[model samples]
Target: MGSAGVRLGRLKANTSALFVCDIQEKFRGLIHGMPAVVDTASRLVRSAEVLEIPVFVTEQYPKALGNTVAELALPPKALVFEKTKFSMCTSDVDKAFRKMNLDGIGQVLLCGIETHVCVLQTVLDLVEKHNVEVHVCVDGVSSQRETDRSVALRRLQGLPNVFLCTSEMAMFQLAGDSKHPKFKQISALAKEKRPDQLSAL
Candidate 1:
Protein backbone atom coordinates (compact mmCIF):
# COMPACT_ATOMS: atom_id res chain seq x y z
CA MET A 1 0.00 0.00 0.00
CA GLY A 2 1.13 3.55 -0.72
CA SER A 3 -0.20 7.02 0.09
CA ALA A 4 -3.84 5.98 0.37
CA GLY A 5 -2.85 2.46 1.46
CA VAL A 6 -4.16 1.02 -1.76
CA ARG A 7 -1.56 0.81 -4.57
CA LEU A 8 2.21 1.19 -4.38
CA GLY A 9 2.61 3.14 -7.61
CA ARG A 10 4.93 5.77 -6.22
CA LEU A 11 8.15 6.08 -4.26
CA LYS A 12 8.49 8.43 -1.32
CA ALA A 13 11.85 9.63 -0.07
CA ASN A 14 11.02 8.63 3.48
CA THR A 15 10.10 5.11 2.40
CA SER A 16 13.01 4.34 0.13
CA ALA A 17 16.45 2.71 0.35
CA LEU A 18 19.02 1.87 -2.29
CA PHE A 19 20.53 -1.60 -2.69
CA VAL A 20 23.72 -2.22 -4.66
CA CYS A 21 24.70 -5.86 -5.06
CA ASP A 22 27.95 -7.54 -6.10
CA ILE A 23 29.40 -4.99 -8.47
CA GLN A 24 32.92 -6.11 -7.66
CA GLU A 25 36.41 -6.11 -9.12
CA LYS A 26 36.58 -9.79 -10.04
CA PHE A 27 33.66 -9.52 -12.43
CA ARG A 28 34.80 -6.23 -13.99
CA GLY A 29 35.67 -7.40 -17.48
CA LEU A 30 33.47 -10.47 -17.37
CA ILE A 31 30.03 -8.87 -17.23
CA HIS A 32 28.40 -7.60 -20.37
CA GLY A 33 27.79 -3.84 -20.38
CA MET A 34 29.85 -3.44 -17.25
CA PRO A 35 30.70 0.17 -17.96
CA ALA A 36 27.08 1.16 -18.32
CA VAL A 37 26.13 -0.84 -15.25
CA VAL A 38 28.77 0.91 -13.18
CA ASP A 39 27.70 4.26 -14.57
CA THR A 40 24.05 3.76 -13.59
CA ALA A 41 24.99 2.34 -10.19
CA SER A 42 27.24 5.30 -9.48
CA ARG A 43 24.49 7.72 -10.47
CA LEU A 44 22.03 5.95 -8.20
CA VAL A 45 24.47 6.04 -5.30
CA ARG A 46 24.98 9.75 -5.72
CA SER A 47 21.24 10.30 -5.94
CA ALA A 48 20.67 8.19 -2.84
CA GLU A 49 23.23 10.22 -0.95
CA VAL A 50 21.60 13.46 -2.01
CA LEU A 51 18.12 12.22 -1.12
CA GLU A 52 19.36 11.03 2.29
CA ILE A 53 18.18 7.51 1.62
CA PRO A 54 20.11 4.81 3.46
CA VAL A 55 22.24 2.70 1.16
CA PHE A 56 22.73 -1.06 1.53
CA VAL A 57 25.44 -2.82 -0.41
CA THR A 58 26.49 -6.45 -0.46
CA GLU A 59 29.64 -8.01 -1.82
CA GLN A 60 29.26 -11.68 -2.59
CA TYR A 61 32.19 -13.72 -1.25
CA PRO A 62 34.46 -10.71 -1.47
CA LYS A 63 37.50 -12.74 -0.45
CA ALA A 64 37.49 -14.35 -3.89
CA LEU A 65 35.23 -12.05 -5.90
CA GLY A 66 37.24 -9.11 -4.60
CA ASN A 67 35.77 -5.85 -3.28
CA THR A 68 33.12 -3.56 -4.75
CA VAL A 69 34.63 -1.70 -7.67
CA ALA A 70 36.35 1.51 -6.64
CA GLU A 71 34.45 3.51 -9.24
CA LEU A 72 31.17 3.08 -7.39
CA ALA A 73 32.41 5.55 -4.71
CA LEU A 74 30.24 4.32 -1.87
CA PRO A 75 29.85 6.91 0.86
CA PRO A 76 31.07 6.41 4.42
CA LYS A 77 27.51 6.09 5.66
CA ALA A 78 26.45 3.35 3.25
CA LEU A 79 26.25 -0.06 4.85
CA VAL A 80 28.63 -2.40 3.07
CA PHE A 81 28.41 -6.06 3.94
CA GLU A 82 30.18 -9.22 2.88
CA LYS A 83 28.29 -12.41 2.16
CA THR A 84 28.99 -15.94 0.88
CA LYS A 85 25.45 -16.29 -0.37
CA PHE A 86 24.28 -15.26 -3.80
CA SER A 87 21.45 -13.22 -2.30
CA MET A 88 22.04 -10.01 -0.35
CA CYS A 89 19.27 -11.07 2.04
CA THR A 90 21.70 -11.87 4.85
CA SER A 91 20.87 -11.64 8.55
CA ASP A 92 22.64 -8.31 8.76
CA VAL A 93 20.67 -6.90 5.85
CA ASP A 94 17.42 -8.17 7.30
CA LYS A 95 18.25 -6.52 10.59
CA ALA A 96 18.89 -3.26 8.89
CA PHE A 97 15.72 -3.53 6.85
CA ARG A 98 13.74 -4.29 9.97
CA LYS A 99 15.09 -1.17 11.62
CA MET A 100 14.32 0.91 8.56
CA ASN A 101 10.85 -0.56 8.32
CA LEU A 102 10.16 0.64 11.80
CA ASP A 103 11.02 4.11 10.55
CA GLY A 104 8.59 3.77 7.55
CA ILE A 105 10.90 2.47 4.86
CA GLY A 106 9.04 -0.03 2.72
CA GLN A 107 10.44 0.63 -0.73
CA VAL A 108 13.75 -0.67 -2.08
CA LEU A 109 15.54 0.65 -5.15
CA LEU A 110 17.90 -2.10 -6.37
CA CYS A 111 20.83 -1.97 -8.80
CA GLY A 112 23.85 -4.20 -9.31
CA ILE A 113 25.65 -7.03 -11.14
CA GLU A 114 24.83 -10.52 -12.36
CA THR A 115 21.11 -9.92 -12.74
CA HIS A 116 20.36 -13.65 -13.06
CA VAL A 117 22.11 -14.65 -9.86
CA CYS A 118 22.47 -12.39 -6.84
CA VAL A 119 20.08 -9.69 -8.02
CA LEU A 120 17.35 -12.19 -8.85
CA GLN A 121 17.68 -14.08 -5.58
CA THR A 122 17.69 -10.91 -3.53
CA VAL A 123 14.59 -9.63 -5.36
CA LEU A 124 12.78 -12.86 -4.57
CA ASP A 125 13.60 -12.68 -0.87
CA LEU A 126 12.67 -9.01 -0.66
CA VAL A 127 9.21 -9.48 -2.18
CA GLU A 128 8.30 -12.96 -0.92
CA LYS A 129 9.78 -12.79 2.55
CA HIS A 130 10.27 -9.13 3.40
CA ASN A 131 6.99 -8.09 1.73
CA VAL A 132 8.40 -4.75 0.61
CA GLU A 133 7.92 -2.94 -2.67
CA VAL A 134 11.00 -3.53 -4.87
CA HIS A 135 12.10 -1.38 -7.77
CA VAL A 136 14.75 -3.01 -9.94
CA CYS A 137 16.76 -0.66 -12.12
CA VAL A 138 17.12 -2.24 -15.52
CA ASP A 139 20.09 -0.21 -16.74
CA GLY A 140 21.77 -0.72 -13.39
CA VAL A 141 21.82 -4.55 -13.40
CA SER A 142 23.23 -7.06 -15.89
CA SER A 143 24.98 -10.43 -16.37
CA GLN A 144 27.88 -11.74 -18.41
CA ARG A 145 25.47 -12.89 -21.04
CA GLU A 146 22.71 -10.72 -22.45
CA THR A 147 20.35 -13.69 -22.54
CA ASP A 148 20.75 -14.38 -18.85
CA ARG A 149 20.26 -10.77 -17.98
CA SER A 150 17.21 -10.42 -20.20
CA VAL A 151 15.59 -13.55 -18.88
CA ALA A 152 16.17 -12.61 -15.28
CA LEU A 153 14.63 -9.19 -15.85
CA ARG A 154 11.62 -10.69 -17.60
CA ARG A 155 11.00 -13.06 -14.73
CA LEU A 156 11.44 -10.30 -12.21
CA GLN A 157 8.89 -8.19 -14.10
CA GLY A 158 6.21 -10.78 -13.52
CA LEU A 159 6.70 -11.02 -9.77
CA PRO A 160 4.27 -9.16 -7.56
CA ASN A 161 5.59 -6.07 -5.73
CA VAL A 162 8.59 -5.95 -8.05
CA PHE A 163 8.84 -2.86 -10.28
CA LEU A 164 11.31 -2.50 -13.12
CA CYS A 165 12.66 0.96 -13.96
CA THR A 166 15.73 2.80 -15.08
CA SER A 167 17.90 4.66 -12.61
CA GLU A 168 16.49 8.07 -13.55
CA MET A 169 12.93 6.84 -13.32
CA ALA A 170 13.39 5.87 -9.68
CA MET A 171 14.97 9.23 -8.87
CA PHE A 172 12.10 11.27 -10.30
CA GLN A 173 9.57 9.02 -8.61
CA LEU A 174 11.22 9.80 -5.30
CA ALA A 175 11.36 13.53 -5.92
CA GLY A 176 7.77 13.48 -7.25
CA ASP A 177 7.97 16.79 -9.13
CA SER A 178 9.76 20.07 -9.82
CA LYS A 179 8.60 21.49 -6.50
CA HIS A 180 10.44 18.87 -4.46
CA PRO A 181 13.18 20.43 -2.36
CA LYS A 182 15.82 18.36 -4.11
CA PHE A 183 14.41 18.64 -7.60
CA LYS A 184 17.25 20.82 -8.86
CA GLN A 185 19.87 18.37 -7.75
CA ILE A 186 17.97 15.50 -9.35
CA SER A 187 17.63 17.48 -12.57
CA ALA A 188 21.36 18.02 -12.67
CA LEU A 189 21.84 14.31 -12.24
CA ALA A 190 19.49 13.58 -15.12
CA LYS A 191 21.47 15.88 -17.40
CA GLU A 192 24.83 14.23 -16.84
CA LYS A 193 24.28 11.34 -19.23
CA ARG A 194 27.06 8.94 -20.20
CA PRO A 195 28.48 9.00 -23.73
CA ASP A 196 26.83 5.77 -24.78
CA GLN A 197 23.46 7.01 -23.63
CA LEU A 198 23.73 10.36 -25.37
CA SER A 199 22.41 10.66 -28.90
CA ALA A 200 23.56 12.90 -31.71
CA LEU A 201 22.27 16.42 -31.34
Candidate 2:
Protein backbone atom coordinates (compact mmCIF):
# COMPACT_ATOMS: atom_id res chain seq x y z
CA MET A 1 0.00 0.00 0.00
CA GLY A 2 1.13 3.56 -0.69
CA SER A 3 1.81 6.12 1.99
CA ALA A 4 -1.33 8.01 1.08
CA GLY A 5 -3.38 4.86 1.43
CA VAL A 6 -1.92 4.16 4.84
CA ARG A 7 -2.36 7.76 5.92
CA LEU A 8 -6.10 7.43 5.31
CA GLY A 9 -6.19 3.86 6.64
CA ARG A 10 -8.44 4.30 9.63
CA LEU A 11 -11.94 3.01 8.79
CA LYS A 12 -14.34 5.51 10.32
CA ALA A 13 -17.97 4.49 10.05
CA ASN A 14 -18.99 7.89 8.79
CA THR A 15 -16.56 7.93 5.84
CA SER A 16 -16.59 4.25 4.93
CA ALA A 17 -19.06 2.24 2.86
CA LEU A 18 -19.38 -1.45 2.03
CA PHE A 19 -19.55 -2.49 -1.59
CA VAL A 20 -20.73 -6.04 -2.31
CA CYS A 21 -20.31 -7.05 -5.93
CA ASP A 22 -22.00 -9.74 -7.96
CA ILE A 23 -22.61 -12.34 -5.30
CA GLN A 24 -25.53 -13.61 -7.29
CA GLU A 25 -27.62 -16.79 -7.24
CA LYS A 26 -26.34 -18.15 -10.54
CA PHE A 27 -22.82 -18.29 -9.16
CA ARG A 28 -23.68 -20.29 -6.06
CA GLY A 29 -23.02 -23.69 -7.61
CA LEU A 30 -20.06 -22.63 -9.71
CA ILE A 31 -17.94 -20.41 -7.49
CA HIS A 32 -15.41 -22.00 -5.21
CA GLY A 33 -16.37 -21.89 -1.55
CA MET A 34 -19.68 -20.24 -2.25
CA PRO A 35 -21.10 -20.97 1.18
CA ALA A 36 -18.11 -19.43 2.95
CA VAL A 37 -18.19 -16.35 0.76
CA VAL A 38 -21.83 -15.78 1.52
CA ASP A 39 -21.27 -16.31 5.21
CA THR A 40 -18.41 -13.83 5.44
CA ALA A 41 -20.17 -11.31 3.22
CA SER A 42 -23.29 -11.49 5.33
CA ARG A 43 -21.32 -10.98 8.49
CA LEU A 44 -19.70 -7.90 7.00
CA VAL A 45 -23.07 -6.53 5.97
CA ARG A 46 -24.52 -6.98 9.43
CA SER A 47 -21.45 -5.43 11.02
CA ALA A 48 -21.69 -2.47 8.67
CA GLU A 49 -25.27 -1.94 9.76
CA VAL A 50 -24.18 -1.94 13.40
CA LEU A 51 -21.55 0.66 12.55
CA GLU A 52 -24.03 2.76 10.57
CA ILE A 53 -21.93 2.36 7.43
CA PRO A 54 -23.81 2.52 4.19
CA VAL A 55 -23.97 -0.61 2.01
CA PHE A 56 -23.94 -0.89 -1.78
CA VAL A 57 -24.66 -4.06 -3.76
CA THR A 58 -24.38 -4.82 -7.44
CA GLU A 59 -25.73 -7.53 -9.74
CA GLN A 60 -24.01 -8.24 -13.02
CA TYR A 61 -26.74 -8.82 -15.57
CA PRO A 62 -29.29 -9.77 -12.93
CA LYS A 63 -31.81 -10.91 -15.49
CA ALA A 64 -29.48 -13.58 -16.81
CA LEU A 65 -27.44 -14.38 -13.73
CA GLY A 66 -30.31 -14.03 -11.25
CA ASN A 67 -30.39 -11.76 -8.19
CA THR A 68 -28.06 -11.58 -5.21
CA VAL A 69 -28.07 -14.75 -3.17
CA ALA A 70 -31.00 -15.18 -0.82
CA GLU A 71 -28.59 -15.78 2.05
CA LEU A 72 -27.42 -12.15 2.21
CA ALA A 73 -29.85 -10.27 4.46
CA LEU A 74 -29.45 -6.95 2.66
CA PRO A 75 -30.84 -4.03 4.59
CA PRO A 76 -33.86 -2.20 3.16
CA LYS A 77 -31.77 0.93 2.72
CA ALA A 78 -28.93 -0.74 0.80
CA LEU A 79 -28.47 0.51 -2.73
CA VAL A 80 -28.83 -2.35 -5.21
CA PHE A 81 -27.86 -1.78 -8.82
CA GLU A 82 -27.79 -3.85 -12.01
CA LYS A 83 -24.91 -3.74 -14.45
CA THR A 84 -23.45 -5.42 -17.51
CA LYS A 85 -19.89 -4.28 -16.76
CA PHE A 86 -17.36 -6.25 -14.82
CA SER A 87 -16.56 -3.19 -12.67
CA MET A 88 -19.12 -1.97 -10.13
CA CYS A 89 -18.09 1.65 -10.86
CA THR A 90 -20.40 1.90 -13.82
CA SER A 91 -22.65 4.81 -14.67
CA ASP A 92 -25.51 3.40 -12.63
CA VAL A 93 -23.24 2.80 -9.67
CA ASP A 94 -21.81 6.31 -9.99
CA LYS A 95 -25.30 7.73 -10.02
CA ALA A 96 -26.13 5.76 -6.90
CA PHE A 97 -23.00 7.07 -5.16
CA ARG A 98 -23.97 10.60 -6.06
CA LYS A 99 -27.52 9.98 -4.96
CA MET A 100 -26.22 8.78 -1.62
CA ASN A 101 -24.14 11.97 -1.35
CA LEU A 102 -20.89 10.07 -0.96
CA ASP A 103 -18.65 12.92 -2.05
CA GLY A 104 -16.77 12.97 1.26
CA ILE A 105 -16.58 9.19 1.65
CA GLY A 106 -13.00 8.08 1.25
CA GLN A 107 -12.86 4.40 2.07
CA VAL A 108 -14.65 1.48 0.40
CA LEU A 109 -14.90 -1.99 1.94
CA LEU A 110 -15.26 -4.45 -0.95
CA CYS A 111 -16.41 -8.06 -1.10
CA GLY A 112 -18.20 -10.63 -3.26
CA ILE A 113 -17.83 -13.15 -6.10
CA GLU A 114 -15.49 -13.98 -8.98
CA THR A 115 -12.45 -12.35 -7.46
CA HIS A 116 -10.50 -12.47 -10.70
CA VAL A 117 -13.26 -10.76 -12.66
CA CYS A 118 -15.94 -8.52 -11.27
CA VAL A 119 -14.33 -8.04 -7.90
CA LEU A 120 -10.89 -7.37 -9.38
CA GLN A 121 -12.18 -4.95 -11.97
CA THR A 122 -14.25 -3.10 -9.43
CA VAL A 123 -11.32 -2.60 -7.08
CA LEU A 124 -9.12 -1.35 -9.89
CA ASP A 125 -11.73 1.11 -11.07
CA LEU A 126 -12.46 2.37 -7.59
CA VAL A 127 -8.80 3.15 -7.07
CA GLU A 128 -7.80 4.33 -10.52
CA LYS A 129 -10.96 6.13 -11.49
CA HIS A 130 -12.51 7.33 -8.29
CA ASN A 131 -9.26 7.59 -6.32
CA VAL A 132 -10.81 5.93 -3.29
CA GLU A 133 -8.95 3.85 -0.74
CA VAL A 134 -10.31 0.29 -0.94
CA HIS A 135 -10.14 -2.58 1.49
CA VAL A 136 -10.84 -6.01 0.03
CA CYS A 137 -12.15 -8.77 2.29
CA VAL A 138 -10.24 -11.85 1.21
CA ASP A 139 -12.55 -14.31 2.94
CA GLY A 140 -15.58 -12.72 1.35
CA VAL A 141 -14.41 -13.09 -2.24
CA SER A 142 -13.80 -16.14 -4.43
CA SER A 143 -13.50 -17.43 -7.96
CA GLN A 144 -14.44 -20.65 -9.76
CA ARG A 145 -10.89 -21.87 -9.07
CA GLU A 146 -8.36 -21.40 -6.31
CA THR A 147 -5.56 -20.40 -8.66
CA ASP A 148 -7.64 -17.62 -10.13
CA ARG A 149 -8.52 -16.27 -6.71
CA SER A 150 -4.87 -16.37 -5.66
CA VAL A 151 -3.77 -14.55 -8.78
CA ALA A 152 -6.36 -11.89 -8.36
CA LEU A 153 -5.32 -11.30 -4.76
CA ARG A 154 -1.68 -11.07 -5.77
CA ARG A 155 -2.50 -8.42 -8.36
CA LEU A 156 -4.63 -6.51 -5.92
CA GLN A 157 -1.77 -6.40 -3.47
CA GLY A 158 0.32 -4.67 -6.12
CA LEU A 159 -2.09 -1.75 -6.20
CA PRO A 160 -1.07 1.07 -3.91
CA ASN A 161 -4.62 2.16 -3.13
CA VAL A 162 -5.92 -1.34 -2.39
CA PHE A 163 -5.51 -3.12 0.92
CA LEU A 164 -6.06 -6.86 1.13
CA CYS A 165 -7.69 -7.87 4.43
CA THR A 166 -10.08 -10.31 6.05
CA SER A 167 -13.65 -9.50 7.03
CA GLU A 168 -12.84 -9.72 10.72
CA MET A 169 -9.83 -7.43 10.35
CA ALA A 170 -11.81 -4.79 8.53
CA MET A 171 -14.67 -4.93 11.02
CA PHE A 172 -12.38 -4.56 14.00
CA GLN A 173 -10.60 -1.66 12.35
CA LEU A 174 -13.96 -0.06 11.79
CA ALA A 175 -14.88 -0.61 15.40
CA GLY A 176 -11.49 0.94 16.38
CA ASP A 177 -11.96 0.51 20.12
CA SER A 178 -13.14 -2.19 22.48
CA LYS A 179 -15.28 0.40 24.18
CA HIS A 180 -17.08 1.30 20.97
CA PRO A 181 -20.82 0.85 21.47
CA LYS A 182 -21.10 -1.76 18.72
CA PHE A 183 -17.80 -3.43 19.46
CA LYS A 184 -19.35 -6.34 21.33
CA GLN A 185 -21.84 -7.09 18.60
CA ILE A 186 -19.27 -6.76 15.85
CA SER A 187 -16.73 -8.85 17.78
CA ALA A 188 -19.24 -11.68 18.12
CA LEU A 189 -19.52 -11.92 14.34
CA ALA A 190 -15.82 -12.74 14.09
CA LYS A 191 -16.04 -15.73 16.42
CA GLU A 192 -17.08 -18.04 13.63
CA LYS A 193 -14.23 -19.94 12.02
CA ARG A 194 -13.32 -19.08 8.50
CA PRO A 195 -14.02 -21.84 5.99
CA ASP A 196 -11.25 -24.39 5.54
CA GLN A 197 -11.04 -23.67 1.85
CA LEU A 198 -10.44 -19.97 2.45
CA SER A 199 -8.03 -20.71 5.26
CA ALA A 200 -5.96 -22.82 2.92
CA LEU A 201 -5.85 -19.95 0.46
Candidate 3:
Protein backbone atom coordinates (compact mmCIF):
# COMPACT_ATOMS: atom_id res chain seq x y z
CA MET A 1 0.00 0.00 0.00
CA GLY A 2 3.01 2.24 -0.43
CA SER A 3 4.50 3.63 -3.64
CA ALA A 4 4.30 0.15 -5.14
CA GLY A 5 0.52 -0.07 -4.73
CA VAL A 6 -0.73 2.74 -6.90
CA ARG A 7 -2.14 1.05 -10.00
CA LEU A 8 -4.02 3.80 -11.78
CA GLY A 9 -3.88 2.26 -15.20
CA ARG A 10 -6.69 2.49 -17.70
CA LEU A 11 -8.65 -0.73 -18.20
CA LYS A 12 -7.24 -1.99 -21.46
CA ALA A 13 -9.50 -4.47 -23.20
CA ASN A 14 -6.82 -7.07 -23.84
CA THR A 15 -5.48 -6.98 -20.31
CA SER A 16 -8.76 -7.04 -18.44
CA ALA A 17 -11.01 -9.80 -17.10
CA LEU A 18 -14.31 -9.98 -15.23
CA PHE A 19 -14.79 -12.09 -12.13
CA VAL A 20 -18.43 -12.79 -11.30
CA CYS A 21 -18.50 -14.20 -7.80
CA ASP A 22 -21.19 -16.38 -6.27
CA ILE A 23 -24.38 -14.90 -7.65
CA GLN A 24 -26.00 -18.24 -7.06
CA GLU A 25 -29.64 -19.32 -6.96
CA LYS A 26 -29.64 -19.69 -3.18
CA PHE A 27 -29.05 -15.97 -2.72
CA ARG A 28 -32.01 -14.91 -4.83
CA GLY A 29 -34.42 -13.90 -2.09
CA LEU A 30 -32.01 -13.28 0.74
CA ILE A 31 -29.54 -10.70 -0.60
CA HIS A 32 -30.48 -7.03 -0.55
CA GLY A 33 -31.14 -5.43 -3.93
CA MET A 34 -30.67 -8.76 -5.63
CA PRO A 35 -32.45 -7.85 -8.83
CA ALA A 36 -30.40 -4.75 -9.49
CA VAL A 37 -27.18 -6.56 -8.62
CA VAL A 38 -27.97 -9.29 -11.13
CA ASP A 39 -28.86 -6.72 -13.75
CA THR A 40 -25.46 -5.04 -13.39
CA ALA A 41 -23.52 -8.30 -13.49
CA SER A 42 -25.41 -9.43 -16.57
CA ARG A 43 -24.57 -6.22 -18.37
CA LEU A 44 -20.86 -6.73 -17.70
CA VAL A 45 -20.99 -10.36 -18.75
CA ARG A 46 -22.64 -9.48 -22.04
CA SER A 47 -20.19 -6.69 -22.62
CA ALA A 48 -17.17 -8.86 -21.81
CA GLU A 49 -18.32 -11.50 -24.28
CA VAL A 50 -18.58 -9.01 -27.11
CA LEU A 51 -15.21 -7.52 -26.19
CA GLU A 52 -13.62 -10.95 -25.99
CA ILE A 53 -12.34 -10.38 -22.47
CA PRO A 54 -11.98 -13.38 -20.21
CA VAL A 55 -14.80 -14.06 -17.74
CA PHE A 56 -14.46 -16.19 -14.61
CA VAL A 57 -17.45 -17.28 -12.54
CA THR A 58 -17.36 -18.92 -9.14
CA GLU A 59 -20.19 -20.78 -7.47
CA GLN A 60 -19.85 -21.03 -3.71
CA TYR A 61 -20.47 -24.63 -2.62
CA PRO A 62 -22.91 -25.16 -5.43
CA LYS A 63 -23.80 -28.57 -4.04
CA ALA A 64 -25.75 -26.84 -1.33
CA LEU A 65 -25.99 -23.25 -2.51
CA GLY A 66 -27.16 -24.07 -6.05
CA ASN A 67 -25.67 -22.84 -9.33
CA THR A 68 -25.39 -19.35 -10.69
CA VAL A 69 -28.84 -17.88 -11.23
CA ALA A 70 -30.53 -18.80 -14.50
CA GLU A 71 -30.74 -15.19 -15.62
CA LEU A 72 -26.99 -15.07 -16.23
CA ALA A 73 -26.58 -17.05 -19.44
CA LEU A 74 -22.79 -17.24 -19.56
CA PRO A 75 -20.89 -17.19 -22.78
CA PRO A 76 -19.53 -20.51 -24.07
CA LYS A 77 -15.99 -19.29 -23.46
CA ALA A 78 -16.54 -18.39 -19.81
CA LEU A 79 -14.70 -20.30 -17.11
CA VAL A 80 -17.04 -21.53 -14.39
CA PHE A 81 -15.86 -23.22 -11.20
CA GLU A 82 -17.34 -24.54 -7.99
CA LYS A 83 -15.75 -23.27 -4.82
CA THR A 84 -16.12 -24.04 -1.12
CA LYS A 85 -13.94 -21.14 -0.02
CA PHE A 86 -15.10 -17.58 0.47
CA SER A 87 -12.37 -16.08 -1.69
CA MET A 88 -12.53 -17.12 -5.32
CA CYS A 89 -8.71 -17.24 -5.22
CA THR A 90 -8.92 -20.95 -4.72
CA SER A 91 -6.01 -22.94 -6.19
CA ASP A 92 -7.79 -23.52 -9.46
CA VAL A 93 -9.03 -20.00 -9.91
CA ASP A 94 -5.73 -18.47 -8.85
CA LYS A 95 -3.78 -20.70 -11.19
CA ALA A 96 -5.99 -19.77 -14.12
CA PHE A 97 -5.89 -16.13 -13.17
CA ARG A 98 -2.12 -16.22 -12.98
CA LYS A 99 -1.95 -17.89 -16.35
CA MET A 100 -4.02 -15.08 -17.78
CA ASN A 101 -1.62 -12.65 -16.15
CA LEU A 102 1.26 -14.12 -18.13
CA ASP A 103 -0.80 -13.43 -21.23
CA GLY A 104 -1.31 -9.72 -20.35
CA ILE A 105 -4.26 -9.66 -17.94
CA GLY A 106 -3.50 -6.87 -15.45
CA GLN A 107 -6.88 -5.72 -14.25
CA VAL A 108 -9.91 -7.63 -12.99
CA LEU A 109 -13.55 -6.61 -12.51
CA LEU A 110 -15.44 -8.14 -9.58
CA CYS A 111 -19.21 -8.43 -9.16
CA GLY A 112 -21.39 -10.54 -6.86
CA ILE A 113 -23.03 -10.93 -3.43
CA GLU A 114 -21.95 -10.64 0.22
CA THR A 115 -19.80 -7.60 -0.43
CA HIS A 116 -18.05 -7.77 2.94
CA VAL A 117 -17.37 -11.45 2.80
CA CYS A 118 -16.26 -13.15 -0.41
CA VAL A 119 -16.07 -9.98 -2.44
CA LEU A 120 -13.94 -8.21 0.14
CA GLN A 121 -11.60 -11.11 0.65
CA THR A 122 -11.15 -11.56 -3.08
CA VAL A 123 -10.21 -7.91 -3.47
CA LEU A 124 -7.56 -8.12 -0.77
CA ASP A 125 -5.96 -11.19 -2.30
CA LEU A 126 -5.97 -9.81 -5.82
CA VAL A 127 -4.23 -6.65 -4.75
CA GLU A 128 -1.99 -7.94 -1.99
CA LYS A 129 -1.22 -11.43 -3.14
CA HIS A 130 -1.51 -11.35 -6.92
CA ASN A 131 -0.77 -7.64 -7.41
CA VAL A 132 -3.65 -7.25 -9.81
CA GLU A 133 -5.49 -3.98 -10.13
CA VAL A 134 -9.14 -4.57 -9.28
CA HIS A 135 -12.36 -2.73 -9.87
CA VAL A 136 -15.50 -3.73 -7.96
CA CYS A 137 -18.92 -3.27 -9.54
CA VAL A 138 -20.59 -1.20 -6.86
CA ASP A 139 -24.07 -1.71 -8.23
CA GLY A 140 -23.39 -5.37 -8.93
CA VAL A 141 -22.55 -6.46 -5.37
CA SER A 142 -24.88 -6.68 -2.39
CA SER A 143 -25.24 -8.12 1.11
CA GLN A 144 -28.08 -9.29 3.33
CA ARG A 145 -27.76 -5.96 5.11
CA GLU A 146 -27.25 -2.46 3.76
CA THR A 147 -24.82 -1.48 6.47
CA ASP A 148 -22.54 -4.35 5.68
CA ARG A 149 -22.53 -3.58 1.98
CA SER A 150 -21.97 0.13 2.49
CA VAL A 151 -19.15 -0.29 4.96
CA ALA A 152 -17.43 -2.85 2.81
CA LEU A 153 -17.60 -0.58 -0.21
CA ARG A 154 -16.11 2.32 1.73
CA ARG A 155 -13.33 0.10 2.95
CA LEU A 156 -12.60 -1.13 -0.55
CA GLN A 157 -12.39 2.43 -1.86
CA GLY A 158 -9.58 3.16 0.56
CA LEU A 159 -7.32 0.40 -0.69
CA PRO A 160 -4.57 0.90 -3.20
CA ASN A 161 -4.93 -0.86 -6.56
CA VAL A 162 -8.62 -1.33 -5.74
CA PHE A 163 -11.46 0.88 -6.95
CA LEU A 164 -15.24 0.88 -6.76
CA CYS A 165 -17.16 1.51 -9.97
CA THR A 166 -20.51 0.88 -11.57
CA SER A 167 -20.81 -1.80 -14.25
CA GLU A 168 -21.80 0.62 -17.03
CA MET A 169 -18.84 2.83 -16.28
CA ALA A 170 -16.53 -0.13 -16.55
CA MET A 171 -17.91 -1.28 -19.91
CA PHE A 172 -17.23 2.07 -21.49
CA GLN A 173 -13.80 2.32 -19.93
CA LEU A 174 -12.81 -1.00 -21.41
CA ALA A 175 -14.07 0.04 -24.81
CA GLY A 176 -12.03 3.25 -24.42
CA ASP A 177 -13.27 5.07 -27.53
CA SER A 178 -16.38 5.15 -29.68
CA LYS A 179 -14.26 4.13 -32.65
CA HIS A 180 -13.61 0.76 -31.03
CA PRO A 181 -14.92 -2.15 -33.08
CA LYS A 182 -17.21 -3.23 -30.26
CA PHE A 183 -18.48 0.29 -29.60
CA LYS A 184 -21.95 -0.44 -30.91
CA GLN A 185 -22.50 -3.34 -28.54
CA ILE A 186 -20.95 -1.54 -25.59
CA SER A 187 -23.07 1.52 -26.32
CA ALA A 188 -26.22 -0.53 -26.35
CA LEU A 189 -25.43 -1.73 -22.84
CA ALA A 190 -25.44 1.85 -21.58
CA LYS A 191 -28.90 2.64 -22.90
CA GLU A 192 -30.63 0.46 -20.34
CA LYS A 193 -31.73 1.76 -16.94
CA ARG A 194 -28.80 0.52 -14.86
CA PRO A 195 -29.09 -0.49 -11.25
CA ASP A 196 -27.34 2.70 -10.19
CA GLN A 197 -30.26 4.60 -11.68
CA LEU A 198 -32.87 2.97 -9.46
CA SER A 199 -34.90 5.46 -7.48
CA ALA A 200 -35.29 5.67 -3.76
CA LEU A 201 -37.67 3.13 -2.32
Clashing pairs for model 3 are none
Where in model 1 is the C-alpha error above 4 Å?
2-6, 195-201
Better TM-score candidate (1, 2): 1
Give the runs in model 3 whose Cα sits over 4 Å from its true position.
Answer: 1-6, 194-201
lDDT of each: 0.88, 0.86, 0.88
Looking at model 2, the pairs that clash are none
| Ranking of all candidate structures by their lDDT, best first | 3, 1, 2
lDDT of 1 at 134: 91
Kindly list the per-residue Cα lDDT of model 1 for residues 48-128, writing each as its tens digit: 998999999999888999999998899999999999888999999999888888889988999998899999999999987
Per-model TM-score on C-alpha atoms: 0.93, 0.92, 0.93
Task: Supply the global lDDT for candidate 3.
Answer: 0.88
